[model samples]
Target: MAKGKHNPERKAVRHGTEKGSVTLGGRRVAVEKIRVRSVDGVEIPLETYQALQDPELLTRAALERMIHGLSTRNYAYGLEPVGDDVESFGTSNSTVSRRFIAVRQLKST
Candidate 1:
């Protein structure tokens, strides 16, 4: 059998944000990024940070990423799913709303 390949020396990522950044459009932004440690134990922050001022816009963008990921089967959902896969994660409106709130809380925390 063919064994799955993995990165044995891959470093873990640490999430953090740097606030009070100014954009080219004269808008303030809070940067979000992940840090990785090298041999010297020096944390190198990834070059990732964008100015997203609108909360609803950020929420929509995140949801879009999730939906796109599902469509692309990015979560190891395989090229496709079994018959009942989609139905399995189904939730009611209130449940979904609560989950959305929880996700927002995650950003705040």
Candidate 2:
């Protein structure tokens, strides 16, 4: 730790696995492959999991999640977005900050 440098506190990410299925319009499609792991307690498709590995997809998901969390009262409180999260989502600090501002504006509206 640096004498004067500060590592901002951040929210903890809980990862777990659950068994489930992928549904389309509330119906499961047998043609597509599905896999289940404890993630948010929902069944996701294999493609969905693969897409999560894609940087572009992750950035989009991060932006969406940031907006949703930032605008929600329960999530807005004690929401500390660290650089690591931003970096892991394949986006920059400036972009994340911009998204935060957008969320704030939306919430204020």
Candidate 3:
């Protein structure tokens, strides 16, 4: 007899097939798209996205503003005297001194 071609199907057992849609988290919710407009009359589509993946971006923004304010004050008033009244002025004397040193170090770097 001629040998039959290799067929793994003859040695296999049939298993029950599964039929169902896989739901993730919960039932899928339909989201509506939003349209946006620019000053130049351009129509843009806005998508809902997660806020600030990098927290450092926010810190850098605030730090930039703080540095700008400090620089302006230093130039205008020649660095206010660090004394007991510093806290009443919205910042502590030690904190101000630390910030001054940190800025000087940053500039030197």
Best by TM-score: 1
Candidate 3 accuracy as TM-score: 0.21
Cα distance off (Å), candidate 2, residue 35: 17
Clashing pairs for model 3 are: none
Error of 1 at 38 (Å): 2.3
| Model 2 per-residue lDDT tens digits across residues 1-109 | 6776654652232344544432222112223234454434554445674533343433344456555654322332323444332222223445545555665677799
The 0-to-1 C-alpha lDDT of every candidate, in the order given, reads 0.41, 0.41, 0.37
lDDT value for model 2:
0.41
lDDT head-to-head 2 vs 3, winner: 2
Candidate 1 lDDT = 0.41
Per-residue CA lDDT of candidate 1, range 1-109, in tens?
3376655665654445543332211112333334466545777644533333434443443345455653222322322333432222212334334545767788899
- Weakest 10 consecutive residues, lDDT, candidate 3? 20-29
Q: Which stretches of candidate 1 lie over 4 Å from their true place?
A: 1-6, 15-24, 48-109
- Ten residues in a row with the worst lDDT in model 2? 23-32
